[model samples]
Target: MNRLADKVALITGAARGQGASEAELFAAEGARVVVADILDDPGRETARAVGGEYLHLDVSAPADWEQAAAFVRESFGRLDILVNNAGIAPPRPARFDEIDLAAHLRLFDVNVHGAFYGIRAMLPLLELGHGASVINVSSIDGLAGVGSMASYVASKHALTGLTRSIAIDLGPLGIRVNSIHPGIISTPLVQTVGPARIARLQRTVGRQPLGRMGEPQEIAAMALFLASDEASYCTGAQFTVDGGHLAGPYREPPADPDETLD
Candidate 1:
């Protein structure tokens, strides 16, 4: 149960969804967790539920990142894991040419630059652990394209690149870095895109190999593995938790004739 015993983890966007799941799971495994999010009330509640400390953080703001890192340093004295999980998808679908410039920029600010800021700000504490780990929560959009999610896809792609680059730079120092790509998980984030659209997306997902949407805990499981010593030799890897969405289009095989079997 104590896979992460003696560790300290900071998870951004921990008020809900995959981040909250990771925080709870990490705490269950005996790690001291810091839940950072802009939602003060929900964040505090999540922290209380998980026996973690809550930090108010707007990942797009550099000063917030600095404050969050400082809080972790002062509270825990060292950091063992950083989960860059704060991100925002566009509220509604828009074509490439129809997307608002402000929305696009905001998506990058939180999804891409936020991770960058977190890694830089937490480096000192992470280094203090001597063998810390970083988990960047990208999306299936990061690995492949989804029509109308151009900005989110681009931002996640940038995050994946950053993961690889930093892994190379930090590997010699004993810090492992990796990115996770989750498929359509049932989370509040889905509400932003509207129910009609989400309904259609779910129908599509149901046709995939797993034939179902994933739960937050499933992705949290991946984060836990990446953060643990079990993955000591793993770094700069892209782990996709999608339900075989990337395997290929689901197709029914042709029926075979009895003569063929004979």
Candidate 2:
């Protein structure tokens, strides 16, 4: 335990999914975590469960971010880790032309712009921490495109670029930055389709070399490594916890019924 001893971490979207898992794990590892999310009740509960603080933060709003920054400074004195895990995805499948323009714009507001705001708002405290780490949770879509998620793909791709650019900018300041690309993970974000639909999707997990969807804890483990002193030399890097989904397509041709091997 105590992989993150004496660290103060602010994790956005900590009410659920990968964010919640990160908060739990960070606290277990002896970090004082701040769970920030728009979901008031659940966010507060999650914070209470983990003995962390909950801040009601709408990541897209600058004022909310300012308030969060103030709270962190006043409550923690210094911030050692910032996990930009809060994000939203398109609810329905849509071709590029069929996609709603407003929703598409909103995607960037939360997924891309929110991350920027987090980094900007927390920089002061980060510097005070001596050597801080910033973890941006991108997706497999960030590495490649998906058929129906045009806006999500675009936003995550932008996050990957943002991660790289800022890593170089912040490296000199002793703040390490990196992005994570998660494949078909079993999170509420992906479970919105309901249990039955999710079950069907699980069948396709075999297509990935790991042959199963990833768990939120699996992603949290990566975050811990990046946030802790263990990864002091790691920065501006994109880590893939993708179950080999991006490696390549796994396929096997059918055998001919009428043919026999000699």
Worst 10 residues of 1 by lDDT: 253-262
lDDT of 2 by residue, 1-262 (tens): 9999989999999999899999999999999999999999999999999999999999999899999999999998989999999988887778999999999999999999999999999999999994799999999899998888898899999999999999999999999999999888989888897777687667667656777899999999999999999999999999999888888886432255474433
Each candidate structure's TM-score, on Cα atoms with residue i matched to residue i, is 0.94, 0.93
lDDT of 2 at 56: 98
Q: Per-residue lDDT for 159 in model 1?
A: 94
Q: Which stretches of candidate 2 lie over 4 Å from their true place?
A: 194-200, 251-262
Tell me how many residue pairs clash in candidate 1.
0
RMSD of each: 3.8, 3.5
Error of 2 at 256 (Å): 18
Please give, for residues 207-237, the per-residue lDDT of candidate 1 as tens digits: 6788678899999999999999999999999
Residue pairs with colliding backbones in model 1 are none
lDDT (CA) per prediction: 0.90, 0.92
